[model samples]
Target: MWSGDELDLDAYLERIGLRENPLAPGELRADLATLYAVHRAHTAAITFESLDVLLGRPVALDVKSIEGKLVHGRRGGYCYEQNSLLAAALERIGFEVTGRGARNRTRGDSLLAVTHAVLVVTVDGEEWLCDAGFGHQGPREPVPLGRPGADVEQGKWTYRIREEEDGVLALCLLRGDTWRDLYAFSPQRYHPVDYVVLNHYSSGHPHSSFVGRVIVQRPGDDVRRALVGRELTSLHPDGRIERRLVGPDEILTVLDREFGLRLPDREAEELVGMYLAGD
Candidate 1:
């Protein structure tokens, strides 16, 4: 179960630019509208990155640690940290949040391991797929579950949930004229301990994509951007992708200016060193 009780809800709301508390008297309701607003605000504010793994640090999943790093420390994290913090906040807000494990279908024909973490929130007997972790190409708002072939438009991007075999569901995005699969998940419910195991592989294993690479992404409404290793790719809604290589001298500035991530002096130097050494 997500440790919702341990989360500081007020601080989290403020971190996501919700200055006034939503839970104030007559201010908010734990419904679909509240869920959409929080989910959109969270994805817009916090970026998706895995800097700690490259720095040889363990990515902690506890709510307190996550708040310290993401909310207060002004940093970004990968899927596990991002979605865990989101799950806790949603749970604290009295939403029925269920954790799930998803496979990375974007990789290719080979079936990948279930390493991605997502959330399903039920409101008024309706389930919505609320994922705040899947980087730039991720959906900004909740996609209605059990409604296959229904296109949910969030800003300029469009997404749909497609039904697959064995009751699996695939979240697809509209790219030009094609609907591309982002990721897929079974109906199996996952717990916090399950993510702990998945996070171990993603954050530490040599074969993991987060290992020895600088991966940072921001899911913008109009243009989504991701910085992987040295290449910076900007994706537009019209299927136009602009990619450029970021030199070592410009990495920190790019992170700050583009992704809104500014590391401390020590970590900055360490990250630059890693980039220089080709780690």
Candidate 2:
């Protein structure tokens, strides 16, 4: 339900790291394909993290803050915040978009208790899956839901989509003849509150990964991530894994130099101290 006044094409494009806005549905010579391509490239370069929360600056789950944190700053954002804002943008651009509930297929078989939000867009009689909040790098390009073997790029990850029973779709990564399930989602329209509840659990739950640890991931030609108290791992396009041991102080340096993330003086020191103390 995005109106013209709320849809600022320039700001949206800039937030996603596009130099110029691409043609969207019903626009001048709109090309949904290229638009999808551009978005995918842009999203891969950024990451999604709860660094703000861990740093004691929790952002409210609202439109303006979501737009500023996710799009304006061009930083990584969680599902509800990222997808909701993107959906609003697509709507303004004249795309027939719908919000869908998604489940962490990697977690297990659970259908009723969905935990993620994704977008399905129909342009020129084709359905494309648009997910911008999956991670630092996920499929930014729209995936054709009808094809048998469709691959989309998200950073260095190649997401392959295949058909499943009951008209559901299974999305996996093609790695050495193996398809790893990242998640599965249906094109069911979800309400705003549906996302709010999930977002709360993801951000606040004690056992949730975000609440317990610090993580920052960026999908490059080589994907890299730093997990607190764990070895830093980098996944190359050729399937080679590079690992490094990071210390407490190194974390702060990496955060500033590598991720472009700046922490408050005291907060940065505390994060270092916490890891050093193994607390």
Error of 2 at 143 (Å): 1.5
lDDT of 2: 0.64
Each model's TM-score, in the order given?
A: 0.97, 0.81
- Span of 10 residues, lowest total lDDT, candidate 2: 21-30
**Per-residue C-alpha lDDT of model 2 across residues 59-107, encoded as one tens digit per residue:** 4566677767666666556677767777766666567777778777655
Best by TM-score: 1
Q: Write the per-residue lDDT of candidate 1 for residues 1-279, one digit (tens) a residue.
A: 689899988788888887564645245567988888889889988999999998898999988999999999989888889999999988888899998899988877888999999999999999999999999999999999979999999889999999989999999999888889999999999999999999999999999999988899999988999999899999999999999999878999999999999998999999888777773
| Model 2 lDDT, residue 132, Cα | 70
